[model samples]
Target: MSPTDLGPGGPATIGAAVAHHAAHIPDHPAIVCEGRTLTYQQLHRGANQAARALAAADARAGSRVAYLGVESEWYYELYVACARTGAVLVPINWRLTPPEIEHILRDSGAELLVASEDHLAALDGIRGDLPQLGAVVSLAGYESWRAGRDPADLPDTTDRQTPVVQLYTSGTTGLPKGVVLAQRSFFAVREALADAGLDWIDWQPDDVSLIGIPGFHVGGIWWASQGLVAGVTNVAMPFFDSSVAVGLIRGRGVTTMCVVPAMLRLILREPGVGKADFDQLRKVVYGGSPIASSLLTEAVEAMGASFAQIYGLTETGNTSICLPPADHQPGSPRLAAAGRPYPGFAAKIIDGDGGPVPPGTVGEVCLRTPARMLEYWGMPDATSATLVDGWIHTGDAGYLDEDGYLYICDRIKDMIIVAGEKIYPTEVENALIQHPAVAETAVVGVPDDRFGEAVHAFVALDPGAQATPRDLATFLKGRIATFKIPVRFTFLERIPRNPSGKILRRELRERFWTDRVRQVN
Candidate 1:
């Protein structure tokens, strides 16, 4: 299809977006990765040729094409190529164990894998277990493969509902599940923002965005696709390093980036970070975990940029709730809130009975958005359980205020019941992180005969800082209720977190509940 055939609604599909930009602004830089820059024309032609390469490897529409590597231009090219061929791109987390990687490949029934040379070793022993895998291609040989095919666009048979990307869950609670997302997941929010004239997140003509989050996660793909669709320059780092990211932001003149809270914290702590020029950095969008109030203030002062907080999951197509720049005042009460929903998005709190709760009542947060995921791949029961009647039951436990602001207390499964009193781990963790001696902390419920279940905390102290358990408990006297104070404190060099930097409370709870009959009290 020609670029004009995409219609005036704007490039609503991934393939259409790439093709449209190529026809209109062919010379504009599309991606800059590892000292190499690819313009829109190059990205478009490269994706077209890569789509032909997929066909040569026997991949067809609906086939799963797996990719194992760090973020790069090749990964993005394959992302658009999957769109062109109506195939599904499965991005495997590079940090996963070999068994975990094998599980996703086997479960997805991927026909072909394109991995970087660095990761070929991980797949060596497991290739025999994957009977459906037809062929494997190294990133080093990608150019030769692309050069063998014709640089032409494929037929645009795919539509908005066609699945293009399948991202696995972080597997914090259990084994990772494939989250199938359609083309609509990437463009719906942009269309909604345009119709509402909201700049909660915007892509300017001169914007240069940094792809800091890895491609295996939803946040990374969501942010990167935005820059491509808007026809702007995107600078990608294969992996995140505070020092390298700081240098790129200053040296490359990166204007905006999307990162988790942990990444922002590390960036601020980089040695000699103050010497870098951040004048061109315009916006810093962060999410993934709750940011301590002090860190938020510190980031605001350090970056001197507009800050936006997005709240969502892999199942919600990345972001349904956004805390815009205007609400980021120094002492505003809404600073703690998760912000209102997008123009076409809706959120409501529901109690145990699955009925709507009154304002300010903590309950499960459900969302109705145009960008929600299609379903958990091959899991009908799970699809039904999570997505019911056009609403997504986000497992997050939060409340809505009178003004419609979302206040996320914690994950529902992470809530601890202390003598029948509900205690959200985030509240205790947030309070603990405020202490001068604490660098990071995670709280869980441990079996206790007296209280049925008592708050147990795992902490990582700041370097050279010392504080006894009693000192911390005393520090929490007025901040939280006496019952909410942690009964046992275990200090560690660092807390275990998943690749996305989310605390793995399940791991901590495993130690305490190993001999118990049930996980809960």
Candidate 2:
């Protein structure tokens, strides 16, 4: 894009980017979903109509418009439409329960809701309970709803600092918190990277990217934003399924995709994946949790795609620390690290007192980056506690090496203190999964009068495989330190996790602490 087309400050906003592409590449493919492809012209026209409809519904600059649906052309149109009208889009997690959905709608003060037919039904009884909601429209009849409206001119309303997305954190601890992300925090950093001429992995106009993760995640929207901003064709999968994903990559010639570690593991476990053609795939970016180096090794061997690991929180734009393609080789020590920060991002480890920790010492990971969120909506205390001196206090515990590779240990809250020894659950779970019969495992700290807190592991056995807790305990005896070994084992049909694929240790600890006043021992 030319400097004259960018939004007054130096970089273009998402709305500006889309407008530039529509004007220059009108015939180019933009979004493909459910067998229908929308060219840039179609996408822009639909977004124009949606923006006019929403504008008529009283949505203006800074107004909130919530959406409840799986990914589709309608979803993308509404997302861009919100940018055209300067309304903030809140993409709801369709996997969430009705009450949870209601909580987010209320919390975001969403004035209008655009939902799929099924999602609209999910809010049937609770629709009246929302006081700030001005209207709710169903995607099933979205075309008819906008029938009378003509394609309106793109409004010159939004700027880089406009809060375009308000992503609510998946509430594992309690109620989900809204993490407000502005265009500058989301796209300005990428603009900086381009200015620096760093193009290790970037969106090319010819790239056919895949949007597979649920749109509720920052990574999901952020991934799609890259494709949209760069004028690349994007294939939108309603949801990520291992089998369906392989087909999309092979059938559509997908060049890039962003996925979580669990999704990659599942795809590898899928039958015939070894024989599948991945010659067209250039990059597969995984994040939201640390990829077990063992799993990463297998993925690297199976798919020809270059693997990159991104580490960040919803509060920090999509990614600040990235393990680039060069560091993904098997046996590379950097594979276990979260790579160095991006060109414009900086990070450090801080002790409990907020002072810097020495290199190689584990502490709370803190990041100062252009992509950091504005604030946690309605959470002044949390915003204050998390954002200090322009640095985001990431709850994750990790250490930075001399070469600047950051190695993640575990969440500070999830760290188990047993008999004065600190035991990160992932360390124990990693050792447990090495057992042949162990399919999945989750480790959490449970109350114990003997050690103040005891480690308890929940294990899911492989199909048609059986192993007693004693057998697994014997197997783990020499693998990890005895102090780090789980004190108790409980068999489970499946391990519980949030949608983003992070294990819900709090859910596993609930049964053990049902009668206790506090969760902690």
Candidate 3:
């Protein structure tokens, strides 16, 4: 392996430069959050102190530490502390139910849990069920614990290959799966970002980044790491609110921001949306789901040409595919594609037998990259199923054109079959989103006696716009083949989505076929 590959003393591990920046940029703003700002020196000291506390509590390297908090400066410090101590940081989604949270806490064998005051109540309800959880530290209580400790001499024992994070899958199907990402995986993502022309969005000493996505997701964790790695300032919001995001961008002169499609839609719909100058904004990275071409065009017009798109999953670090600013043209062919594979990442479509598919033939998208996850936590069977012959089966159905641009068709499991024809939900959803009345749409397969499975759509309309099921069906009838049109349409106030804004088709299907013997194939 090259020296650039993650190992001891490599630039990929947070410990590689933590002390360097802590001493050099001690006074530089490391994080700006909720009217309070922390300098690099403070962050370093805070993380060190937290590490000492964990050590004092018998937490050792490779130990699991569950972080149960919303976005906060303290949350970042805890993450860094885990990295410094060689502990696996497992971030729990605050949106999950108590039982769901309990399952992760137990399954990961987490001995330490750092939770916010709001989340503490939830933990209290399930504390008795988690015998393995040794300690529950509250963010609000950390200050008192560190009052007497000297943080400068805390022990640092991080190794480059050590697992840094265990991110749980969104679990739209069943229980969430834990994806283990090592320090090497993170370093690979940073290197890929630099190699993919995204270095221009690199953090500077004075740069403040507005983080709108939930810290539990990849967008928040990876982007936050990018800022920290460059010793730049990061401004975090506890939860997503369009007015607050707009205020931070304009008020704090935020130079960079990471957002999801729904967040962008909310920001664009804000009443004072057009009033914000956003002159300080340098780049707006959008991902998590396929972005509508129309939304991309409007975003460029609203936020300038700073919008960039990234495509990746938790199991593949954070970014493997990137559509750079140069590809954001009004009618560029690349806009329809998911851009090119990141440097050091090789992607291809494979058929049922695992043979490479020819260009333009839809199949499973497989990736081979340094940034791939170590394994699915405690799931050797699933891991073996996904990672075969050094390639990660992405389970996404897409084709690569002759130019090597990736055109994502849909999820392999989400393909709708109607009257012997295959219909991709993303295609139908993409076409539906173009309509002015539609805000969001999710397509799923529903039971039908004639057709083995029929295409069904659940839509959320734009504010003050009304459209019936027949109207939407008629709108799509001419755009696609007759077989591809949705057989049933349900107008909902809002579609159910996971924390990352990916629509929950499994939930939609369960409502109709939960009791039926024939569940989704």
The model with the greatest TM-score is 1
Q: In model 1, where do residues sit more than 4 Å from their true spots?
A: 1-7, 170-173, 415-521
TM-score for every candidate vs. truth?
0.80, 0.79, 0.78
Q: Residue-wise lDDT of candidate 1 within 230-257, one digit each (tens)?
A: 8889999998878889999999999999
Candidate numbers, best TM-score first, in rank order: 1, 2, 3
lDDT, residue 158, candidate 3: 68
The TM-score between candidate 3 and the true structure equals: 0.78
Pairs clashing within candidate 2: none
Question: For all the candidates, what are their Cα RMSDs to the real structure?
Answer: 10.9, 10.8, 11.2
TM-score of 1: 0.80
Clash number by candidate, in order: 0, 0, 0
Model 2: residues >4 Å from true position, as ranges? Answer: 1-11, 171-173, 415-521
lDDT of 1: 0.85
Q: Least lDDT summed over 10 consecutive residues: which range in candidate 2? A: 2-11
Query: How does residue 291 of candidate 2 score in lDDT?
Result: 56
Which of 1 and 3 is ahead in TM-score? Answer: 1
